[model samples]
Target: MMPLVHSLSADDEIFSVSVSHDGTRVAASYNDAIMIWDTHTGCRTLGPLKGHEYWVWSVAFSPDGRSLASGSSDNTIRIWDTETGTELLEPLNQHTDEVTLVLYSYAGTFLISGSDDHTVNIWDPYTGNLIGPPIDTGDRVSSVAISPDSTKIAIASFNNTLRIYDFATVSPILHDFTIHVCDAATGISIGNPFRGHTNVVTSVAFSPDCRYIASGSDDMMIILWDAVTGQICAEPLAGHSSGISAVVFTSEGSLLVSGSRDHSIKVWDVGAVIRRVELANGSNSIVTQRIDLEITSVMSLKDVVSRLTDWGCTDMSAELDWTSVGDYPISQGGFGDIYRCKLTDGHEVAVKTLRVYVDPDEQTRKSLKHAAREIYTWSKLKHPNVQPLLGLVVFREQVGMLATWEPNGNLPSYIERNRETDRCLLGAQIAEGLAYLHDLGVVHGDLKGVNVLVSKDEIAQLADFGNAVLREYTIQFSKTSTKHNISPRWTAPELFRGSKYSMEADVYALGMV
Candidate 1:
């Protein structure tokens, strides 16, 4: 029978309304009962599908358009098959308080409910069994959403702060760079590693003005790591088409810049990227938004060199002097290939290049980008004890980053060459550098006597961040073993079990040094 619009709207006040994905049906909650209508005909199609003991407050249609979910003041939630208007099951009773909102994931694989009970629970709509642990909202949860990727959830609560959780379960994550928190007082571990990156972390840098950390990896993706929780702050940034070699924030900290083996430098608006990440992380039902603020510019290596030159980065054209080039590389462990060269200004600089056998003309630019990934991080650091970088340059035959020369060489060699002259001051300087890096939430990755170089002034500086973990374990790449790439003599025993690198591991290396 056709229901008179005037009678339906005037006599019955509706609390909520949801339209089917196909636009063929509408479900509206009215006075403890729900009415389903043929949207075009204004005729009641189904319901007063009533079983609720109290007022109905929320309603939503499943993604497939075949089911409807409802929450009510009765402290119960129900699912109704849209086709036959049949209740799917008895009301789910895990929530102790009123159910405020009900929603479905994109694939209709699960249902989510928010309640006055201060918790959010995922349910198997078909079986009514709860999935995983009930997420405590800390207060009455008003709204909740799962990210587009279904990897995270955001909850808005009465506490006035929004909380985000990773719905994805934690795994061993040995191939990924994780930030592990440990207690300063007792030297014991605190919690799980901030695990998100998909590949070995070759480089990490702190945003100058923000609470974010950036990491580059062989996976060719750049992840913005949250400094506070060691969680990923945004989606993996993807324009480079090759592994990221280096990443850094601009002087103002408003923009982030990354260089890739693709021989391109891309500038990003950090705030915009973060906001986009938040929205995409909010709900799987939401479409990912692409904004201009996220990407400002993409530049070729030639352009980057010219721009820096215009900004007074200093000319190194004359440094091509073959005689000034070192007879052999300083060493070859952490993405090795280093040569000592003199700049046109007479300043000695070390050029670190990757040894790729592919012909530049025949090689795809993508392949070259992977080769450049090892040395790009040097340009962003400026600590008195951090490796001082001059600039990055792209060459047809050789692409690389440049750093100020440390004539005193590595600590181990410097000590061996100069005899046991106490070396207390150098050790203290190395400790100071480590403190600086840890304060920024960065792990040196490859911290050894060979990676720590000393200046003529006797101050020790840290280098070779890419080697902090084993980037290329060609033979045992996937074999889970008790031994990782770290040297047994200096590494912590716990890591000997083929685990990932953490800040604590770096500290352990420092002790051995």
Candidate 2:
């Protein structure tokens, strides 16, 4: 489609563009700078943001429209307050190499960035904290997109793989799709990745409804697949002059926009032939976009229980108005501060606010994923001995996990206050919980006293799965606990050796009771 008016100079080679959520401002990356344009004011350049030392590769506006994030070849991502033009963060210095792409999740609660270092990092745009640990792709990532609802993230990499991760589990649900299809009814299968992409897959996108995912490869073809069934549709989108560089579904979902080395953009008529009734106009409405132009662009966790090492934040408590809970000082640690608060529904919860001190880019990402996993795991374990998960509040700059507020405090404190016999019973309860987890194929990777919570009923409940793994637990029992209650003394010699111990190992450790 031709522009009504040239928003960018033809010779400037605009690499990426993102319109503000309000549609009032537009930011485009070109070479080493990011240029902002007043969309309603005839696309005039408002000013140039010369913050990056190298080519600015990607740009995004925060959900509130208060800030901007730019990724550059300088191997950093910078956060800027849009209103005052002040840098909120010094170049985000986690990526070891060039920052190739960056984007904001639909809610504007998180930023996802991909780097030439073959890693994808998610960050808190506001505090510049790492959301979770860096996701190692083992190949340079070219593009990244979070699903509209922000529940699933799709990453394309030089390894010729498309990785799909669950926003909750923070674990990969799908990987390396090569032309494959399973029958929806009979469950039949066909095709292979090697046959479909003669070269490499370069771009991918989810349909607005997220029912389908479309991928374009260096083979000059666009393949649409059933997102749920993984079956190829009726036809491959053909017409690109050369290898495709990028592909995206129009906002309206009426067409596909693709760019290629053929030096032109091509608009494909995907839904054009479908019939539609226009109720507003009381007639049949037909819509289509002509794609023939091509251009290019590119794109955890756990917890510990050490109250002394933890630091609290006023900002998070202020956001939730938990000050009424009294003068409880929240402290920071591997996770953020732990706060006790009441939800709007009158439910009491223990909320953990994740923070940043230095450059938290990497740590922030890991924390988010860790929080997500904890929520997922806790939600599934319906045992009374397991701490209940209430919900979570996640934003671009911060993330907090909410859980059942046990006023009785942690197991270590409870054990400290009670008799040795009571401690022995508590240890048995923990063992029972561990035995249950093993029955369900879950392994609490870091078993410690702080991870256990004591309820008002005097029941010992297992908490904290930040370092837990779903696979078999094989670490040597020597892994000490952060809280000096049971980990170091109760841990077994075999665990410290990192041998292939079984559920019996946890039982043996618990026998110290």
Candidate 3:
């Protein structure tokens, strides 16, 4: 496809380019300077705003298009007034190494930056104050982007991983090179990572509507991702002859502009691309469901609890005292929080409650049903390598599952404590637990080091059945309902290709563990 508007030539190599929210102005950064151009006439409206001591790697426009932010190899970030071509405030110099990328939140409330210093920093654009401590990514940061809602931040780094973190809590949730979607609030990875690029991913951007993600790679291709299902929306967008340096969707999301090392900028008509992909697939519609907004299961909280009781699982809600439960959760996950609590019988247990922040009515229902399904599956297991489900309790007006609290914590923490511990035995115990689950026709869909807990006896036990399902009866439910609960780094390759979780996939995850 031909670019809708390609009208800029630079004597120097362009490191990055950004389009204003109004889609009228374009900002390009190169060799210690920034320039602004009129989109239609290709006229340079603003020139060579030069103050940086070294190469400027990134430039971005605020939502209002009145200000521009640039990051440079000088290890500084500067804000520039778009109209007067003057530097705003002081140089924001928190990074210790070259600043690679800078981006403003969709609301223009704060600015985010990534650097070769291996940190991602959040700053207030107006006051130029650092928001919090810098996030230590442990690898040189390459590119950074904030989601449309401004709740999550996605950082691509030199370590070949793209990680998503909650903007409010600064918790790293999703981690993988293949592009995984995550729940911003609960830090749970949603579905599999979108995988198609054959080379390193260079940049990623989310649409204004938060429905799609566009990623550019060294493979000279741009892939659009369905934000809800973590699926590739269309075929690879191929036009740039050299590696793509940057990509951005216009404020309205109708046009996508890409910059390349080929010294060219190409604007793609996104609507036309979608239309062509749909026609090629012989379908009028591309998206079948919005997983976040829709509920696919018919089971309700009442039905789930009734099924659990019918199956002879203990319901501790009536017998347990809710006052003994901890007032705050010790840890949090996508579906809920984990709290250490004590039973009236003097035994200690970990209580996990559903943590739903949005769409309380529908989400609570779905979460309750999911929790109940987990309880049902967990109650069927009785193995030494698996954590046993003691019972179900109602606390804080939410249903929580109870299990024996392992003092040694998860596998990662356990290994951190005992560096000389035998990992082979831990791996074997994990395999034993997984084999037990598969023998009973259950697929532990999500498995990772974090999901493996170390008991006081120094034994590895499998926990967290939020994604487990009975193979014969729930093939479809496992494929669709809990699809978002997967951890991409530990996920089997076939799951990324749309295969349902099976015993073979479980074995593959065991290998990853």
Candidate 1 local accuracy as lDDT? 0.62
Query: Where does model 2 exceed 4 Å of error?
Result: 1-5, 149-151, 167-513
TM-score of each candidate?
Answer: 0.36, 0.39, 0.48
Q: Choose 1 or 2, whichever is better by lDDT.
A: 1
TM-score of 2: 0.39
On lDDT, the leading prediction is: 3
- Order the numbered candidates by TM-score, best leading: 3, 2, 1
For residues 305-424, could you state the per-residue lDDT of candidate 3 as single tens digits?
546677667877765656776668998775467888877887778987644221345545555445555566677565557898888755565557889889899999999999999898
lDDT of candidate 1 over 120-157, digit per residue (tens): 98998889899999889898876566655665767768
lDDT of 3: 0.74
Candidate lDDT (C-alpha), each: 0.62, 0.58, 0.74
lDDT by residue (tens digit), candidate 2, 1-513: 111112233224455555566545666666776666554233444446777898877777887778889999999999877776678887898999999888888888888899999999988876789988999988988767576687677776877666667632111212343544433222235333323555567666666666666777778888776666566553677766577656666544434555555634444534321111121223322112111111111101113211101312112232344444545535444434576677655667777654421123544333333333343445555444667555555422344666778877887777677755366657666875786566455666556677789987677888765545554121111112122122566576786777644456556655654
User: Worst 10-residue stretch by lDDT in candidate 3?
Assistant: 285-294
